[model samples]
Target: MRADACRNLDTLLQTGAKVLARDPSASITQIAAEAGLDRRTVYRRFATREALLVALFEAKLDEAERVLDEARLTEAPIAVALHRYVEGIVPVSRQWPLDFSSLESPDHVTEKRRQQLRARLSAFVDRGVDEGFFRADVPRTWVRKLLDDLVKLAAHSNPEMEPPKAADLVVEILLRGAGKQ
Candidate 1:
């Protein structure tokens, strides 16, 4: 409710995400210590580890939604928008790295957000088709799938390849396949 309280909650969530990412078995007390907040504060915000995990999941999605908005997926030129989206999403995918088979199921609100994100991305691909950037002969769904996989690949940045370079490579491959032109 208050500014300081909101900040504390955000810190707890952010630190909890990093800590849990590194060690999934991390405890609430550990999260609070890492976040520099009192254990009671974390307990007040989240009654249990599952509750904290659910909050982390929602926080991850919330951040991703913001990144997508910043990408200007619909308004920008397809090439520029694709580049922005890839660059923006790489860190997010790396940080959150959602496990579709996770034990914790997403709540309805999170599921709806996922659907909304997918629809936005699908629309972007359709726009690309309309503008002749992508092959019109290919199904929009296929194109969207291709883009999703490529972005994921880019997100798994290799030690030899920096994230931006990896993202650029993905964009190039998406535009022009591996085969000789």
Candidate 2:
């Protein structure tokens, strides 16, 4: 695809995410209008609203995979990897805010990718625990859930916060609970 076409597709996806996030029933015309592109442009790429939604989810997964790869979780020091992952993912969580659990019938490929991402994250957490960055006593599932919740909270609740700042806040809160110590 041409550069301009790619830009338009990206714009459409980004706008679609925002519009659909606010109102899942939003139409293609509404998304196109919000994206400042012709409705035909969107129609040319996406035959139906569901296609656009799937594309959005795929895009989110792509970004997440990219962030995870960039963080080098397996090779980097546990603390550095944790911070890098948080910093990279906060913006992605903000940009593609769709909740995968809400999908009625997600595509197999998407679901597989999502599971792969989760496994990678779980492994990273385990590494952190082994390295003494995370408490070994805590259930790994709880730690993972807390990380996910904190990232979502930072991204959605503090919309104005920069990604790095949000990452710092999340890391601090995760590593050190709200205690007098």
Candidate 3:
């Protein structure tokens, strides 16, 4: 694409992220209008709400890597690092209502991005096992799958409106299943 077109695309994506961050209900036209473009132009780049959202999700994941780095990886506990997995997931969850689970299988590129994150978690889980933090028998792959399922649940649930008991339910599940034995 031409340099000016590239700039316009970037502007559209930035404007869309801003609009969604503030209000996920913000329409594509609103995003286009905010970016000084037409709805057709916006869809030209994005194709669909899910596509635009996946783009935003990928952007958020990149930001999460920065956050994890800032958290100082080597110094942090394995559980804390594991929490970073959720830390990054929540933004993606917030950006689009069903962000975590709505992820389509065809989106190989983004799926690989998530797999990279899970790989990191797998390594961390292995470390936790060595240090006696996590259970030796708890398979990292299964834990990754479980966390993915849990984030899908957490995406739409209201932990604050609900009792603290609800939030602890998830932690308890993880603890019992992952705690050192």
Give the number of the best model, judged by lDDT: 2
Least accurate stretch of 10 residues (summed lDDT) in model 3?
Answer: 159-168
**TM-score per candidate:** 0.76, 0.92, 0.58
Error of 2 at 16 (Å): 0.5
Residue 111 in candidate 1 has what lDDT? Answer: 74
Stronger candidate by TM-score (1 vs 3): 1
Model 1, runs deviating above 4 Å: 1-8, 22-40, 100-103, 159-163, 178-181
Superposed by TM-score, candidate 3 places the C-alpha of residue 173 at a distance from the truth, in angstroms, of 3.5
Query: Against the true structure, whose TM-score is highest?
Result: 2
Q: Residue by residue across 112-151, what tens digits does model 3's lDDT show?
A: 8867765665666567778887677778667656666666
The residue-by-residue lDDT of candidate 2 on 1-181, one tens digit each, is: 9999999998999988888888877899999999999999999999977788789999999999999999999999876787899999999988998887546678888999999999999998888787778887788888899999999999999899998898888889988852113
Model 1 poorest ten-residue lDDT run: 97-106
Candidate 1 lDDT over 102-175, as tens digits, reads 42655677678778888999898888888888888778887788888887777764534666787798789888
Q: What number of clashing residue pairs does each candidate have, in the order they appear? A: 0, 0, 0
State the displacement of the C-alpha of residue 161, model 2, in Å, after optimal TM-score superposition.
Answer: 1.3
